[model samples]
Target chain A: MAFFILVIAALLVSVFFNSLGAVSLYRFPDVYTRLHGATKCTTFGTIFIAVAVVLYAVGRLLESGENRFWVLIIHTLVAMMVLLVTNATGAHAIARASHRSGLAPAKAVVDRLEESCSRGGASQ
Target chain B: MFIFFASFLMYLLLVWSGSGIPMIEVVIGLLMATVVTFAYKTWHPEKRLSKRGLDPRRWFGFVAYLFGPFALGLAKANIDVAKRVITGKIRPGIVKVTPALKSDVARTLLADSITLTPGTLTVDIDDAGAFYIHWLYVEDENPSEEQLYGNFAHWARRLAE
Candidate 1:
């Protein structure tokens, strides 16, 4: 009963964060802010979902003592790790590319990147 | 070589059945690992493979860092973003920081860590090894490495460099 409750709670958190990611897309004024919201929220939301899956797999393993449950648990862990790495890296690439393509962050307070770019030839 | 043993072990780990693994499966895993290592060596030729990752100390440090500071930062980051999402108050900007990270691996690890840490996102890493980060709330125009990324710089240097 406790395990079920924990799984449901994890799923609920996942759903909440995922919806926030979607809402931020429409709410944010610029690409960088939108990327921040979408990338971090979705990655965190997916982590909770993965946690719920791992918990379910663990419950099955303890109840049935089956070998396949071990595989499920391990694979879910591996998948979560892959998602974490890929999502962060992808966000970095997008930020770098957009900046290089001359997309300054909208409504930014201070733009040090612009200052550095204009100071001297900091080109590659 | 380190790659051979690592791949072989990984293959066995994936195929583990809790029940004792059969000898033929182990044999096949070895054969697959050999083919992979052969292909890898054939392409690289110069055996300049760094064996730093083979160290058990580094692996333990990395695991501890993952579950310790990194996990805490991840939770804090999500909550912070959530608060901003609800309130819609932000002071975003791209600020620069120059950490004395000599190795490419350390730079990469730091950039990725900063991205997932808090209100900071790594936008560009210049050829001169300085990082331009997109901070949701830029506290200072010229921020220190610690201010931008906390102790992640130390962890990155220790773990990767």
Candidate 2:
């Protein structure tokens, strides 16, 4: 009963975040805002899903005393770690590339990078 | 040596069965681990497998980071971004953050953490190790390091430096 409840909760959390992400992707004005919403929501949603899998594996292991479930838990954990690390790195790369390609923030008030670049050029 | 032993143990774990131990599998796993370890050493000769690399304190700090500030930041960022998305209220801009961490590994870790958390995306690292981050909501034209990263830099320094 507890396992089912936990699984249901996890499913709801993931679904909520994922739908919000998709909605934001459609609603946001620019590339940067869209990226922010899409990347973060999906990543957060995936974390919940990973948690659910880990919990299910643990519950199975405890119920049956099976070593295979233990392996499943460990592997799921490794996959979660990889997902977290790679998602951040990949987002950074995309943001950098977008900025370099001259996609400015839509409603930005401050442009520190521009100021810094001019100052750096003057000093050199 | 430590890398070889660790990889050998990992290989054994990967091949472990609930039934009986297999000597043949153990021998093959050991040989494979040794070969992989040697290849790694050849590719990165400067990276020696030292005791410091396996320090329990560092591992503890890393685990603490994953559970503590990182987890909190993820949740907070998600909520904040969700609010921004719903309300269309964002003041996005690029800002410079110069953390005191000197090591390359620590700096990279800090950059990755900042990019992962709360309305921040690490855009570039200059020659002087200053990070240029694209913030989703920029409150100030020139924000302090504390304003940008809270205690993330401190945690990165502890864990990686």
Candidate 3:
């Protein structure tokens, strides 16, 4: 019963953060800003979801008192690991694609990079 | 493969705790993981296990660079959004950014960094390595090319350099 409550709490927290992240993406001014909010909030929400799964596995293990607990725990851990790697890597790829395609800061006063790159001088 | 071996060991521990399983089962599992690991190693024989000679000073500087610029951008976007919402003025558009990052990894870092920030969403990319960003607020009739690429490249170089 306690475990079920924990799972529900975790789910609610994850959902709340994910929607907040989406709202941030919709409300913010540029690509970089939206990515920042979305990535962090989603990553946090993912962690909570993983936590909920772990809690459920523990509950099942306690109830069954059997070997299936290990399977559940290991699979959940593996999924979490995959999520951690893929999310950050995907975010990096998107960011690079956005930058090289020609997006700029809204109110940037100075742009040394543009000057240096255009002048055949390597960026320091 | 390591994961499989770990799983087998876990299985052994579990069976030993609950009900007795044949030792042959554990040995077979270990053999499978060993074979898989060796096969994987052969497929990537030259892969380095760890990056050596990492410069700590540069790495720490990069972390600070990302944190500082990202925070500033987020706060600025928050204010911009608040104003835009109150004024009922939003000119959403997609602008292309050509970040002249020399390396693919560096470019990728910049792209994700930009996407992670508020108010900006990465829409598409081209083979020549350009980013298309959707803006929630477009203040300029003709946004400069540097406007999209400069800020991201600035911190990207600082972080990745």
**Judged by DockQ relative to the true structure, which candidate is superior, 2 or 3?**
2
The residue pairs found clashing in candidate 2 are none
Off by over 4 Å in 3: A109-116, A119-124, B1-45, B48-161
Ranking by DockQ: 1, 2, 3
Clashes of 1: 0
Per-model lDDT: 0.89, 0.81, 0.61
In candidate 1, stretches whose alpha carbon ends up further than 4 angstroms from where it belongs are: B17-47
- Isolated chain B TM-score per model: 0.88, 0.84, 0.58
Docking class of 3: incorrect
Q: Identify the leading candidate in terms of lDDT.
A: 1
- Model 2 agreement with the true structure over A30-94: per-residue lDDT tens digits: 87778888888889998899899988888887789988887777777878887888888888788
Report the C-alpha lDDT of model 3 over B1-161, residue by residue, as the tens digit. Answer: 44456566755654453356787877876786677668768898876443321567767866676458754664454444445444545556556567666655566667655554544556555555666555555555346745643476776765554
Q: Which parts of model 2 have CA positions greater than 4 angstroms off?
A: A118-124, B1-6, B15-28, B31-35, B47-51
Cα lDDT of model 3 by residue, A37-96, tens digit: 666567657867987998988888888877777667777776765674577567656755
Better of 1 and 2 by lDDT: 1
What is the TM-score of each predicted model, taking all chains together? 0.91, 0.88, 0.50
Candidate 2 vs candidate 3: which has greater lDDT? 2
Clashing pairs in 1: none
Q: Lowest summed-lDDT stretch of 10 residues in model 3 chain B?
A: B47-56
